[model samples]
Target: MLRLIIKKEIQSALRDTRIQFAGTFLILLMLVSVLVGRQGQKQIQKERAEAQATMYDKWVNQGAKHPHSAAHYGQFAFKPKPVLSFLDLGLDNYTGVSVFLEAHKQNEVLYSAAQEGNGMTRFGELTAALVLQVLLPLLIIFLTFNIFSREREEGTLKLIHGQGISMRKLLMGKVWGTYALVLLIFIPVICLAYFLLDQASAGFDPHVGVKFMGLLASYSLYLLIFVLLSVIISAFSKSSSFSLLSLLGLWIAACIILPKATTNLADKVYPTPSQYEFRKTIAEKVENGIDGHNPSDARLADLKKQVLDEYNVSKTEDLPVNWRGIAMQAGEEYTDQVYDHEFSKVENIFKKQNRVSEWAGFINPYLAIRNLSMAFSGTDFHHHVAFVKAAENYRRAFVKKMNKDMEVNDKPGTEDYRVDKEMWESIESFSYEAPDIGKIISVQWRSVTALVFWLVALFTLASIYAPKISRL
Candidate 1:
């Protein structure tokens, strides 16, 4: 009987003009979004690669110059584009994609896509993930919101009741049948996009397949929760109009209103410092702590005395190594400490801001899936932070190499200590590999738990109430 009901539901839905139109529009929207996203991804990848190569060439080919000067003439570190980012852009647009690595300064990532765009960009670009996360649920609501309520309104519930079919069985059939219809509409478009993507790629990435599967699984559960909620609402609704309005209200709250509201609340709770203030704070700390460039500074004088005593020499000029290089390196280390401390406070504030939304996933599955999607796509804050850390580490090594060269080879009294391209070439280029999927999932346990809880709670609600819903 359940099977028959499911079959009837599918057959009837298939004949509906509204379902046909919505499905077609969704398919078209996804097709365009995928193609556009792929093109944009390719363009960004190419641009980053060319820019990085140019920066590398300039650094390596820079002729003989002062070692400290060379340290100041730093390189740019471009963040590698993740393969799945084309499918789900996440924070990649807002977060800058490259960082300038130089001496005594930790630069923020530069050249964000959002920075280049106009006001309309704030609304967000249409990506396949957006369609799935926002629009597809709407279609599900449209399909399932009036299921049981319409049956009651048209007096078909009396027929089903007269046939002695339990409301639980009928509800189950509608849920499964609607889910099957969704798959029918959704699968072909996704498969077509995947096929195009595989053909478009220059090389194979094994992780892409695995990550894609993870996306599929996550979206599957997410969509199921919506379908279940829609059917359960329909089953209890007094009329078709009430069912439609209720589901629309729920959709708007989950998909639109709550996301914005939660973000605003988080911002109010944990305010982040402005960029100028953050930089100003770091500069003040470094200035007060040590002046590596100024040998006349009191701290540098102390450092010089301490270094001379450690070497058992009365004067810096009498010492074997260059005092200037030692002072410069000491300043670099002091500045690094200041940057790290301030950056840590900023990072903590971001984490706390993110936490509010992550926990809000329990109330809105949209937030849960949004965070999870960003993680899997490697566009989340954690991934961006990892890239920045890698760049900073490279920058530190780079400055150290220059300082060590001057200390070892230059005369202590030399005014212009120079090193050639040979010394510059000694420092390694920056490289970053995104954290593995397992690590990403570990950081997203809150969202994962929320999704699981939503699934269980929806099923529990259906089980308890479906049997008790009035037939007429």
Candidate 2:
């Protein structure tokens, strides 16, 4: 009986010209987004990879120079593109792609894609994730908003009941049929997405397959919420037009208004310090005591005394190994401590800011899916922070190596000291591996919980409304 009802609804929907046109247009739009995203991803990957290789070459071949001078010459740390980036782009456009690593100061990632683009680019970059998250819900609303109300308006609701078909079964069948329409439209896009991803590189990441499947599952739940909500609203409405209007309003609230408002509220609640103040705070804490090599620092005088005592030397020119390098390394270590504290405070503020919307995921499946989608794609805040920290660690290690080389190879009190290009080998080739799926799930646990909450809530609503279909 359920099969018969589903077949009838499917046949009826197939006969509706509106479904055909809407489905076609949505598919075309998604395909276009995928095409544009693919080109952008390929181009971005090629450019960053080439730039990194060139930068490394320059670093190794840079003529023999004083260790400090070579440290100042610096290397660029270019972040590699994630394999799933084509699907979501996410914060990649907003976050910087490269960072400059030098001696005295740590650098923020620089040269974000948004910085290079025009003002209009801030509107949002087009990607398959945007198509599925925002626009696809619009299509689902168009398809399912009137599924029950139109039957009632046409007086077929009672007539179908008159045939002894329970309203609950009928509603379930309609829900399945409407959802099938979405699958029909989305399946081709899914297949095409897989093909494009498979063909994009010579080697495949196993994790990409896992991440892609998770993307499908998350988006399916998101679409299901829209389907169930639309049908529920239709069941409660007197007219199909009213149902459509009501669903549209709900869509705008969940998808548009709430997201923007949450961000604003989060900012107001947890304000971050200004850049100058942040830097000033770090300098105040670490400047005087850390750098024992600085001649004027009375704070370093004690450290200098201890070092000379440990080296068993009474005068400046007597101790073996460059005590200056030892002092510099100690200063670098202290500077790292100061920066780490300051950076955590800043990062915590950012966490609080995003937490506001993450909680709103319970009210808006759109937010839940947005977070999960970016997490899986490795373009979320969590992923960006991981990359940033990894780059910083590499920079610190490279600086320490240079300092040690200075201490061991160069004589004390010699301004003419220099190192061969071979010293560049102390720094390893930089590579980044994104956090695994397990780590991503931990970071986005709230979003995952919200998605699960919607599944239970929407399903419960669907069951409750299924039995109440007679009221319409």
Candidate 3:
């Protein structure tokens, strides 16, 4: 009986031109988004690869110079777009793609894509995730908003109930049948997306497949929540027009209004410092250390005296190691401490701001899915922070290597000491591995919990109230 009802629902939906047109339009939009996204991804990868290679070439080919000088003429760490970014660009547009790593200074990432775009970018891009998260729910609303209301309008509600069919089974059949139609449209689009992804990469990683499947499952559940809600609304509504209007209003609130309002509220609640203030704070903290450029600074003089006393020598020239190199490294280490302290404060503020939205997921599934999509795609703020930490660590190691070489290899009296190209080539190239799927899930537990809660709550609400449809 359930199978018969489900079949009847599908047959009736197939005869409706509205379902046919909406499904076709959705499929075409998804395919177009994938194509445009793949092109953009390829362009980004190409530009970043070329720029990185060019930067490395310049670094390696830079002529012999003082090790400390070479440290100031530092390298760039360009972030590679993740394989899944083609589906969900996420923060990639706002988060800068690279950082300039130099000695005694911790630079912020610069040159975000958003900075180069026109006003249209403010509206957001048409990525596959956007299509699935926002538009797909609209499609679901269209299909199921009148599932029960239309039966009542046509006086078939009495006939169907009198035929020994339970309202629970009837509701279940309609929900599953609507979902089956959605799958017919969705499955092909996902398969096409996979094909595009596979073709874009030289060899796709198996872990990417895992992330893809995770995305598939997440989006499926997200859509199911909407489907169940629409059905429930239709069951309770007096007429098809009321069901449609109520669902559309809910959609506008959940998809459009809530996300923007949440972001604004979060920013107001946990505002971060401006760039000037942040940099000023770091500079103030660093001034307490020895001045590397001014050898005669009081802190440097004190350090010279301390070192000479330790070595039992009258002057720095008479000491075993070059005093200038020691002083430079000490300054570097002190600046590092200051940078770490200041950067931590900023990171904490960012986390606090994000928490506002993470907790908001309970009220809006769109927020939950938006966060989860970005997390899985490796385009979240966490991933950006990870890249930053990696780049800074590499810069510290590179600068330390140069300072160590100056301390050990340069003669004590040789003030103009310089190193060959071999020294430059010795520094390891920077590399970054994105956080694993496990770490992403751990970080996104709030969103995950919200999704689970919505799913269960909606199911329970439907089961309890769906049977009461007969009284209406």
Candidate 4:
């Protein structure tokens, strides 16, 4: 009986010219977005690779210079683009792609793709994630808003109800029918995306397969939640138009208003200090004797004196090791301590920002699904932080290597010390390996759980009250 009802719903929906047109429009949009996203991804990947190669070449070809001086001339760390970032772009478009590592300072990553254009970027670019998260729900609403109310207005509900059919079966059939329609519109696009990604990245890890499949599963659940919620709204509303307006209000709150509001509220509650203020604070503390920035100060003078005495050297110059290099390395370690504290504070601020949005998942299933999708794709905040941390790690290693080289090869008070450019060529370049999809899934368990809770709550409401819908 449910199969028969579902078939009937499909046939009736197909006969509507509006449904036909909408289906065609969605397919076209998905195809266009896929092509555009793929091309952009290729271009970005090519450019970043070329930039990294050029920087490496420049450093290797640099004239002989003091190892310490070479540290001051530091190199650039270009973040590699994740293969699947083409589909969603996620925060890649908003975040910087490269960071400069130099002596005594940690530069903020530069070149945000979103900031490339004028104010128009605030509207956001077209991407698969945007379509799935923002536009697809509206399409589901359009297809399902009239599912029950239209039948009631036309006296079909009375006729059908008199046929001894339970409202539970009827609504279940309607929801399933609408879900089938959404799949028809979505499945082809997903398959096409997988094919393109496979063809483009020859060395793409198989684990990305898991991430992509999880993305599909999460999106499907999201669409199902929308379809069921719309049907319930239709069952309770007096007319089709009211069902639509109510669903639209819900969509607006979920997709547009709530995410932004929560971010703003979180910033207000746990404010992050400006970079300038943070640096100034560190500098002041260093000047006051703690000297986390420069370890060659009075606070560490005792340690230096001990080392000199142990070596039976009257001054730093008489020591066997290059004291300047040691001092520079010691200074770097101190600065690292200060940076660790500041970066932790910044991370705390971001966590607070995300917590507000995380709790919002209970009120908005779309938020839950969107976050889950990004998390699985390894394109969320966690992945971004991983990249930044990896880059910083590479920077520290490079600096320490230079310092160690200087200590071995340089004589004290001899400014004529220099290392061959070949030494720079010998150093390994930074390479990042993205975390496993399984780990990503583990980290986002809360979001998945929240979405399941939403499904359960909505299904319960529909089951208990759908029968009473006639009382309205």
| Range of the 10 consecutive residues with the lowest summed lDDT in candidate 2 | 287-296
Candidate 3 CA-lDDT value: 0.85
- Candidate lDDT values, in order: 0.85, 0.82, 0.85, 0.81
The residue-by-residue lDDT of candidate 2 on 36-154, one tens digit each, is 78778888888988998999989988988888788889998899887788889899988989999988788878888799889877988778888899988898888777778878888
Q: Which residue segments of model 4 deviate by more than 4 Å?
A: 202-206, 289-296, 413-415
Reference-based TM-score, model 3:
0.94
Candidate 3 regions with alpha-carbon error over 4 angstroms? 202-206, 288-306
What are the models' TM-scores? 0.94, 0.95, 0.94, 0.95
Model 4 residue 267 lDDT?
A: 85
Q: How many clashes would you count in candidate 1? A: 0
Candidate 4: tens digits of C-alpha lDDT, residues 1-472 = 8998889888998898998998888888887898898888888878988898898788787789988788888888887777777667777767788999877777787887777757767677777888888888888889888889999988898988889899998999999988888888898889889898778763534567778888888888888888899999998999999988998999898898988887788889988898789888767655553444444467468668877888898898788888777778877877777778778878988877777777778888877887887776666888888888888888888899899888777867666988877899878776777778777767677778878888899899989987887722
Alpha-carbon RMSD of each model: 2.7, 2.5, 2.8, 2.1
Question: Candidate 3, which ten residues in sequence have the lowest lDDT sum?
Answer: 288-297
Candidate 4 at residue 354, lDDT?
Answer: 75
